[model samples]
Target: MSDAILTLDNVTKVFGRADKPVYAARAVSFALHPGRTLALVGESGSGKTTAARLIMREYTPDEGQLLFRGVPLGKGDARALRNYRSSVQMVFQDPFASLNPTHTIRYHLERPLKLHQKGLTSAQRQAAIVELLERVKLDPKLIMPKFPHELSGGQRQRISIARALAVNPQVIVADEPTSMLDVSVRQGILNLLNDMKAELKLALLYITHDIATARYVADDIMVMYAGQIVEWGAVNKVLDDPQHPYTRLLLSAVPDPDRRFDDVRFADELGRVEEIRTLSARPQPETAQAGENHFYRPFPAV
Candidate 1:
């Protein structure tokens, strides 16, 4: 983590009334290193999007610091903020809604390049768009003229990836990048993300609830519940030997072809669902190491 391009140090974001606050994120800390992907896995309303917003600078952390290359973000001059903005890019979940309805795909990719990459001439910018399209495995000639609506879900997601890469960002915050696409196409998109990370040496924060896909793409994984990362570490280590109850619950929920529907093991776990959720939701400051690269925050005793 010493080579982290972006680090969130005990970042907290709160909402609702001062007297009765809702903790969207509470002391969430993680680092995104170059050429590695950190998958943040959780169910809906688990504060995954809140963490993405914090990284994108869409929401400022109320309690902690966001550091880019070891310097606190937003504390520097206007130019520094602009540079930071350019360095961290986001690929939203809803590909259809993320792009402009009125503009062509070329315009979507061109706008960022024209803004962040200034020296390129009109012809050069156009060529750059083609290269980006090609990089994402799309046929530039066939796709550039079409608007976002004209493309399928997978294609639009690729365009989103292309646009993020358009700025040559150091970190890519992909929030459920494949959830909206067809099941068949999900692997392809995931492969593209993996390819981009390896080729560009980009630090990726792939946020998703899909543990299956997280296992496929991530070098490291963090399991988020309520607003805290209850378990985290090497992808295989954590997934294979999940320490936190919430983490185990998530893994159990994943479909197993070999197991029957009425299996007794998962049923037993499901019986204590409420108890597990309640305990996991409580703030636990203590962390215990389960392995050299694996750790979990122990739930307070009931």
Candidate 2:
């Protein structure tokens, strides 16, 4: 994590009341390194989107700090804030909603370039836009004139990716980039994201509930529950031999052709779902190293 582009250090975001607080994110810490993807995985209401929002500056942290390139991101400095905004970009979950319905694909991609790269002339901006379209593997001539509605779900998602890349971002926070796409096209999008990370040397935070896709694209993985990262480590280490109960619970839920339907081990894990969740949600400040690259926050003693 020495070369982290973005770091969330014990960051917490709370909502509701002081008397009965709701922790959207509680002392959550993770780092995004250049040329690597760190996946944040959990079910809905598990603070996955909240963490993304914190990085995007949509929700300022109630506690801890967000660091950009080893410097604490402070709100007081206007120039620094502008630089942070330009450096970090996001690809939303719903591709259709992220793009403006009235604007052509060209307009959508061109607007970011016009705003961020103001020195570029109109002709130069057009060329840059075409380059971006090609980077996302789209035919610029055929897709540029079409509106969001005119493209398929997969194409629109590609446009979203193109727009995020338009700003020449150092960090790309993609929230469930493949969840909304057709199964047939999901792999293509995942492949494109992996390619972008390697080619652009971008630090990526890929958020999703799908462990399968996370394993496919991510270098490291974080398992979150009740707003806390209960377990995290190298993708294969965490997935192959999950250390935390919640991580095991999640992996068990994924379909396995080799495992019998009446397998007793999985059934036992499923039966204790509520019990495990309850224990895992409690504040556990203690972390134990499970392997050379694997670690988990131990569940608090009852």
Candidate 3:
């Protein structure tokens, strides 16, 4: 009953046929409050993207419903869905792939304004585009005329962000926005995102495998393993005092170092992480709150 902008109530996503199906997301539940960020952290194939997809309305959940400001979204109304799309935007993982190579950056930003802000004239649309570019700290005159490939990776990412903001979105789902950029430029992008969130008060869903980056922007963190959220709470509390085995296994992997991305070092702990993942994925039998904010889904037999 919180004043959350977006909430997923026991969301689940299954793939393949009934006989042999994979539950990409299992009863995943979380809320994105206005002016705050939620960091969905896990290794690859841990259902981080699946959660993002569910929020973005790209994939419908088979079990639960998605609520926007406490009202469930239905397919019957075009106007509501259109408004939802305009308010909810996304910045993809690969900036280059997200943009069109043939089109200039200005074209990309202007199209959204034309579609969403019909009240604005051509002159006003152009001005808005320039302002959007400047908001991401990109020089409008120089960067707007250039194509996607002409700019650097970081610049392309800035353009991607600029486009997402063109329609004046209230929520942004950035799926690993910095994972593709060079290490040197990653900090700049992270800072830019932090600034935008503060200025616009947008609810952001930052999906990534890098826990260190998540610590920088997220107010809350949800640790996912084997397509389920095993631990979730305030960012520092859960990350600093992680109780679940899979959460600890994810933290032990040196995120900034040259360590293997998938190499959960605790892999040798008598299958502790995987065993916990399978056990945790099942529905929690009852509520067991650890503290004011900390919560963990207990294993079936543990």
lDDT of 2 by residue, 26-83 (tens): 9999999999999999999999999999999989999999998898987756666666
Lowest lDDT sum, 10 consecutive residues, model 2, at: 74-83
Q: Score every model by TM-score.
A: 0.97, 0.98, 0.92
Candidate 2, 53: how far from true, in Å? 0.4
User: In model 3, where do residues sit more than 4 Å from their true spots?
Assistant: 256-287
Clashes of each: 0, 0, 0
Tens-digit lDDT track for model 1 on 210-297? Answer: 8999999999999998889899999999999999999988888888788887888988788888999999888978989999889999
lDDT of 1 at 142: 99
The models' CA-based lDDT, in order, is 0.92, 0.93, 0.85
- Tens-digit lDDT track of model 3 for 279-302: 666656454566768788765565
* Model 3 global lDDT (CA atoms, 0 to 1): 0.85
- Which residue runs does candidate 1 get wrong by more than 4 Å? 75-78
How far residue 200's Cα lies from its native spot in candidate 2, in Å, is 0.4
Worst 10 residues of 3 by lDDT: 261-270
